[model samples]
Target: MVLYLQYNRGMTPTEAGQIMMLQAVMMTICAPIAGRLSDLWGSRVLATVGCLIIATGLGILVQVNDRMPLVVIAGSMMAIGLGHGLFSTPNNSTAIGTVAAAKLGIATATLNLARQCGQLLGTAVLSLLIAIFFDGRSITPQGYKDFQSVAVWALSISLAFSLMAAWFSSRKG
Candidate 1:
């Protein structure tokens, strides 16, 4: 969304769309690597590292204001997508592995619910920040930058939760 909003500035729509397209390409490229890492190490480790990297990327993206927010966002998206690929399948497998077969349904439901709740919280917080910071004035590069800064703050908090989750998941029961 930040990248999309960046288009409201002087950048052309084509350029913004291309940035999104590049994100897709990078995600595709990273998915397999993520899977490999999950296989080699553990899902918890990979996910924790990926989440940290993503948080770092977002934090850095806000600070850098070159004409390259697109590139930066794409890289961050790829890190995140890779983390998802690494964490999701293996984490699900681990969940099932930990629980009895009869409880698999409940486990899956819990996972999905947690995911949705997190998404809801993130969206709500982001909306509030944008409303507070992004005045209805014309969307300028500075406005978009402000949006990015707020987003980084939100993502950092989210990443903290993810890190905690990873740590808990890795603990021996």
Candidate 2:
């Protein structure tokens, strides 16, 4: 979004910063509330709902165009923020809770490692997709279209994985 705003839309750095700030604000407000709700209600339902909301947000983003309104973009970002806020706390709690006291440190480290690995993998995949799609082309309408296609594919795959997570969370031990 920063790149698109800077390169395609000619937005100033401050403008981009403002847009990102909006997302940050949403995330900050939602995270603790989501965490409290998860504590009371359990992770399964909260996480599942988060995943679905994230999927819906991504689905909305998949259709974004250069001409899309700032409001729409901000709204999508808010949805994503809400989802992440809802998903992270209870998911971490559940993972840590499943381990014995003797293994708590190991479980925490493993969970953090998994998260970093997932981030790395996601970055690599996105980079590969961008390389394949861009092929040395400048940002253009066609390039944006290609990006949209890649984003749709990535988001769809993410949605499926999140749904699987939700399903697994819902399962009895």
Best by lDDT: 2
- List the candidate 1 regions with Cα displacement exceeding 4 Å: 7-40, 64-69, 134-148, 159-173
**Candidate number with greatest TM-score:** 2
Q: Write the per-residue lDDT of candidate 1 for residues 12-112, one digit (tens) a residue.
A: 76765665565466556766777676677767776556556555555554444445555566676666655555556566656666888899899889989
Query: Distance from true position, residue 99, model 1, in Å?
Result: 1.4
Cα lDDT of candidate 1 equals: 0.63
Error of 2 at 100 (Å): 1.4
For candidate 2, the lDDT comes to 0.75
TM-score of each: 0.68, 0.83
* lDDT over C-alpha atoms for residue 43 of model 2: 86
**Pairs clashing within candidate 2:** none
Clashing pairs in 1: none
